[model samples]
Target: MSGLRPASAGRGESGRYEAFDHLATMVAVLRAADGCCLFVNAAFEAALGLPRRALLRRGRLFDWFVDASALVTNYQAVVANQYSTVRLEALLRRPTAPHAEPLPVHVIVTQVDHGETILLELVEIEQQARQDRETRTLDQVRVTKELIRNLAHEIKNPLGGIRGAAQLLEMDLADATLTEYTQVIIHEADRLQALVDRLLAPHRRPHMVADVNIHEVLERVRSLVLAEFSRGLTIVRDYDASLPEFRGDREQLIQAVLNITHNAALALAERRQAGDARIVLRTRAARQVTIGRQRYRLALELHIEDNGPGVPPEIRDRIFFPLVSGREGGSGLGLTLAQDFIQQHQGLIECESEPGRTLFKIQIPLP
Candidate 1:
């Protein structure tokens, strides 16, 4: 074992490394010679499903991985000054429960101060994949929103001209039958105008921000859906009363939730006739959650689940894309608008669907 080194003050103080605990990635400082752990952050402890004291007492960090050969070789190389940094993929063992599997991680190692120890960072493989997916999703959403807005503006300009021309033609028409044709043109043009307005609604409306009680929003959505699907539809509420209110746009949240619940009710049409339709609105508070690219200490998790046919596999990945629908006569803007509004509040919406069980989960950061 390497001899213990005394703290030299300033940056060498043990407290200095405490800031690493706030990071989402697992981190550890190790003695390169024998792989003894000198420091392990909160994320490292949580990822290993062990207490910080326990991990520190265990003495060596090499045993944490399923296979330590690769790590051992790299640690030695860094210790011998063969390389300044190294990265490899490994499976980290979890000893928390029976039959638990090891977690796949991308390991990064770099020499620390004095060259006696090295800093090790473990990035969860799933987290890296999620980060990539979020980046792509955000990029796509930005491009789609811009394209839709520009297209809507182009349509809106022509729409007014069409309606005005139709009105003028109706007034000058000598034959009553020809007036009917003009009226048809005017009516169709008005319908198209309304459609365009709906498409531009998110961009046009101002965000009315206020202190919002999420439960209140759910309650409002619950009542609206219940009233619409009064017969054979059971709306169950499973709420965590301890959840605190946060700043948000209350009306936008209400509409976002209402859209999902309404879609759930519509999907349960077959079960509604059999008198066994069910929709669940469940809420709880989650801690240390990563939403999109940022991590939050606390967030509100709201789940809208239904007992109905699952989303079609072909369109499941595109549900949040504008004008993508799985149901007949669906305008396909409900989920898209819901996503837009949730994103405005710096939150995320995810859906998991399977036969007889479809769940839409919304996570919003809380103060």
Candidate 2:
């Protein structure tokens, strides 16, 4: 509770509670005697699917729970100095549109100000699981990147030596027919060298900085992808006109987007033959987005959605890993490069796929 103190009130009590609004976790403050709601943070309010005024009008925070008996008994115990903190699982009722089911949550209630004020935090069980999963994924990706970078460096020098030796052998060969074998060795070595370069490209390239218009980047990707798949692929632009320009490497963004869009086009091969392949490039401004561990007040959301057979269930999770591909003959570095580029801007990329639709979502913070 050291830095958790409410801000000093200048205009009103609600103004003092503004400090809690920045937190990604749901928080509520209530009077301990009767469990009357005093303040609800942005996350809490959003979870309850109600405005602050409406929530306060309802009064008791306990009423929002499906079974208030557990909370009520715990609240009384905490207020009576029986305990300083209590943690339990509960089902919270949301009466707003789009929330059709009771939300399962982990609730933490702590006595503050000598048990006069109660601090309550509610973490959605699903949200907590998602955060945990994302944390694990990020950690795994970091370890994988480090290993790949080190392995690529180890292979790089030997690769050049192998190609040079093969070239020298070919030049000194007595029989022209035998030179074919050396040529094969040189060609294969060059191919492996190229593969190693792709693996190391993101680490080697400096992050160039400039103001980037996301729409322009998408349009560039759209045109490039359409050029390759000229006949049946349709790239639809659904741009948010009010989105602000952000500082980033314009070329990197373009290439990242191009990679994703090109993959979507390739996935639509069967649909392309039918002349109905479609991809949507949608952009919007996202609020209160938690990317990685940091929460951003505003961020850009770019979704590249395609109407193709979704990513294979077997390889879906590893799509961003180097050399893991759902498509045949895929080099599998596209999504990996895209992820690395977006991460260089302190952003993240996620994919959601089903039978008929696959969406690649990218999030970058805005000023």
Candidate 3:
């Protein structure tokens, strides 16, 4: 919890936790002496689904909480300069969803600046559980990445020796038929070496960053996909032209899109062998989008959607895992690498699949 910085009373964080928009905890700063609201962070606004304009207009800072009397008492305690901190679980209402149930939150109130101002923190009960699940998933991914890197290195160590031995054996064999067996061994070794290299690739290379035009990347992928699947598939474009450029690795983004598009094309081909296969490349600006716990004001959404047989039920949950493949002879590293690249940009990839329809949605925050 060393990374946890206390939000200041007067105006949340005193420049410390001010930029901690990623925390799911809703926080606000208030004028302690008068019980007036001061500043509210992104998480708070997103949690309640209310704009700052509406929140501040609702009345006192603590008015959003259900037990107004409890908040009043808490504020009194702060103003009196008796206790430095207070905590309680409270039901918090949202102006946007008035008819719905109030959000259950664990609230914290603290006096700072010699009781001149108060800091309030609200952590949603359900969001905490969601965060825990996300943390567990991330930890599993970390462990898997390490495992892939280590295993790839282990396989690589003896790989060169095996391939070299096979080559030498091939040269020694006078019988062409027997030499063909040695050639098979060499070919397989080379294939394994290539796979191992791909497994180790992300760790070996440093990310290249530049201002990326998403449409340009999409266009490149579109052209490549069309060239490959010229006759069978129909690729449709649905783009929001107003989106702005953001910094990222252009090559990485291209690869991510390519891998997803390529997979969609394959799936489409399998489901509809007689043509009428359709794949859609969609781009849109997502406003006030929350990825995991963090809320971004603006984000880019790139969707590669296809009409195909849905993901196989058994492997659906493990689709992004390294070496898990739906298609026969599929490397299975495409989605894994695609996921890794997007995560490098503080982005996420989500999938939705059903009979005759499969969609892969990639989201990255736009600065």
Candidate 4:
């Protein structure tokens, strides 16, 4: 009877452990003193790529982070404040590939067991961030394109009439001094005509969809920028060789990519002692991207990054709108047109900026 009793207790313990191990969501238990993880479910192990054995002996929960000391201090404060839950970003280094880029994580930390232990749950951030960016870019493109189309139409008829009236006055007027006023009217009309033409150009052109190779488009833009700014700037290519050809208008795509690269080059040109003024053209393949609430099988991601003084905060939010420029004497229609072209091809363009590093990402469907 005593031997049977011991066997029954052992089986019960094993059954309970197995039940928690097979849970759908990730869960972990840690020691309160130093935050060493004592138990981790299978889901937790798969998400973090950390085994139970390794985490069980950890000195602190933040020890596995690339920036461990800072993370620990920040987290300790959050817990000490008696906060029930806290959320923040954490960069965790992989055990095998410590030197590689740290994994970006959205962490949720909560106090458990009467503030004795802390529970940390992490979700990858890149995918969510990309989606948010795409949504914003698409919205901007749609709104800007509509505005450009409407404004161009509204200005075209009036501009033509003004120019015609100026010509008539110049022909009939006798006073030489009055001729200058008519000439001014004619010149202003011509300037507005030019702006209107640029605004209408994207919509007026017919799209020629072809099996376009994105790298080729990027390479062409790189060569053109290098030819003009070759004196003090360098363009770097970091393309993913395996990226497949996407169906898009070749000429329009080239124009779109060129506009972004050209803007970056111009920004770099205005800096003093801009060490290694560089624009990096990079490509990657993305999966499960949602556009307009519809999920895509594959998407082509092209990034144009620069190390220039970042975009001005004043006009950053309205950068895609026509006539909004950060530089003095700059026509801001370049990005507006670029956005229009990419949107026509069912793609999105987004920008992230900070001092010394700015990234513009273009994503298009791969089919």
Give each model a TM-score.
Answer: 0.90, 0.93, 0.70, 0.68
For model 4, how does the per-residue alpha-carbon lDDT over 1-367 read when each residue is reduced to its tens digit?
1011122345542232444454433456555566666566665565567776665566455667777675566557656855667777878777766667888877767666566666666666875676676677677767767877887899999899999999998999988789999999999999989989998998788888789998889888889988888777888889899998878899999899999889898899755244579889999997645665576667888899999989999988788888999988888889988888887877777888999999998878886
Kindly list the per-residue Cα lDDT of model 3 for residues 130-233, writing each as its tens digit: 55655565666778888998899899989899999988888888888898788888899999999999988877788999999999999999999999998878
Q: Give one clash count per candidate, in the order shown.
A: 0, 0, 1, 0
lDDT measured at residue 24 in model 2 versus the true structure, 0 to 100: 76
lDDT of 1: 0.88
Please give the lDDT score at residue 37 for candidate 3: 78
Overall local distance difference test of candidate 3: 0.82
Query: What overall lDDT goes with each candidate model?
Result: 0.88, 0.88, 0.82, 0.76
Give the Cα error of residue 298 in candidate 2, in Å: 1.6
Model 1 CA RMSD to the hidden true structure, in angstroms? 3.4
The ten-residue window of minimal lDDT in model 2 covers 2-11
Best candidate (score: TM-score): 2
Candidate 1, position 56, lDDT: 88
| Candidate 4 CA-lDDT value | 0.76
Of candidate 1, the 10-residue stretch with the lowest lDDT total is 1-10
Query: Which pairs in model 1 have colliding backbones?
Result: none
